[model samples]
Target: MTPPLALDIDGTLTTPSGRIDPRVFELLPDWDAPVVFATGKAFPYPVALAHFLGRPEFVIAENGGVAYVDGETAVLGDPTAPRAVVEAFRERGGEVGWGDGDTVNRWRETEVALSLDADEALLREVAAAADGDVTVVDTGYAYHVKSPAASKGKALERVADALGIATEAFVAIGDSENDASTFAVAGESYAVANADATAREAADVVLDEAYMDGTETVLAALRERGE
Candidate 1:
């Protein structure tokens, strides 16, 4: 059997503005392999995408705080991060937009998606305010305030176990800092040409194209290898 494909949705499979390029759909290989989405997008987004794909295999959402598969959803990480953390950041004059009741953040169980500029110092202060129990992950699009245990790699392990597939029987692809964990754990990891330096360093293969074009490139390579 072909190994499952674990994909990061945002910069890995969509345009910079997060739209799926129609050309990407055209390039999708005709295969029965499981296509698991490992992303920081909220639960509903990935679930809807899976439904559109006609294959709702598995989804790792909110940077591994949640997992959905086979009509069942599970919280994979601790949901105890204090809500005051966001307030504290705001008090410190950090611009933060919470995704609590929004379309994407509503489905998040533990993590709080904060739409803000990437300020490492401010993020560190926010993490400290949470008593070090929460960590800030820069997902390229936003900073997620989540438990230290939340990670895409851990989610992949859980999904792989459920599918009865070895960890080595998977291909992981992404384009940002949060994706570094997925790249580290995948059997074969790939990054699009536009991926950040950290992701590029972690990947075994880096495609020349960007976004969905890069995704198509990797999928084609995987198909060739399987052939």
Candidate 2:
């Protein structure tokens, strides 16, 4: 049987040039096993991606602050924790930079995500000193301000339980520090060749090819073995 897949978007499934490869949208739905899109993106992004891809809406989003499985959504973490930190960041002259009517966060439920264009260094400094247990993660494409109560590792266990599969049955693929948590909990994990140091260290295998090329290689091998 094919092992279930937990995949990260952005740098993992995208081309080296950062566009979502059409091949990925094709391959994911064809996989015989379940596929969960895990990411620092908000819930709607993955839900929408799965719908458009005709894949299952098993998603771990907002860096695990929110998850959707079997059509029901479970929310974790303190929604206000990161909001407060962002406010502090702005107070300290850190502009969110997304400007008015920011659509990226309009649908988010449990945390604040800033564009990489935002001041990463200032945001981290502010989040670290903020009250509560929130933290910042750099996902290459963006920066997320999220609560410690939420993490992809912790959320993956929930996904496993609801699917009636062990976390060890899932193979995680990703390319950022945000994906490190899921890598820790998965039975096997692959870091794309362009993966950040944190994800590389956490993964069981580091691929030779970069981006979606790496993903296709891994998927091809798994399907060949029928596991």
Candidate 3:
């Protein structure tokens, strides 16, 4: 059976500055398998990254709250909180804005990329002001506020359902706090050398080297799996 693979963009497939490694780019066209771009980035960001990775047919973006299949966007469940929830969070003296892929992310002439944890007092205050059901995940960059039900694992399940494959057929790779759940649930998982301690703990394998080499490592793993 051919294995299905999912790749994270930022620190896995690309450099810290977001450039795709040329050597890895050369290998992508020769790669075989149903590869998915599972990233915390938004639509266009991941799309650009996937284009670099050989235009994968399926993508799980916005931390798995949003999915793009054959170029169509399918929002599975509520990835973002309701307007009221956002309002309540703001009421608690916390500044909330749209992040990375947030279509509604319009703030200070810059695209909102989520929230930063400035102080524990502020974190508690924002958590309290929001609807009790909000899911606040640490994405290394910021506090990702979403519905408790939205996650990369759930998004992977959707892709599996669409492909008529079991969850065990998937391999997930990532390198940050946001990738924890995705890594935790995948049949096989890998963490890049640049991954933080939290990401390393959740992964089955810690990549032996940094970003560019990590892509090569992942491709090697895929080839071994007969992808």
RMSD value for candidate 3:
4.2
lDDT values, one for every candidate? 0.79, 0.88, 0.68
Candidate ranking under TM-score, highest first, comes to: 2, 1, 3
Tens digits of per-residue lDDT for model 3, 1-227: 44677777778877777676677568665556677888766666666666756666688877777777765667764533434454555676656544455553431111123556434355545656665656555666556556666677888878777777777777878888777777866788888899888889999999888776876777776787673
Candidate 2 is scored at a TM of 0.96
TM-score of each: 0.90, 0.96, 0.79
Off by over 4 Å in 2: none
- lDDT by residue (44-138, candidate 2, tens digit) is 88888899999889999999998889978899878787898899898988887788998878988998889889988889888878765788888
- List model 1 lDDT by residue over 100-176, tens digit each: 45565666677777775545588677779667788887777888888888788888888878888876788998998
Cα shift from native, residue 6, model 1 (Å): 0.2
Alpha carbon lDDT of residue 43, candidate 1? 81
Clashes of 2: 0
Top candidate, metric TM-score: 2
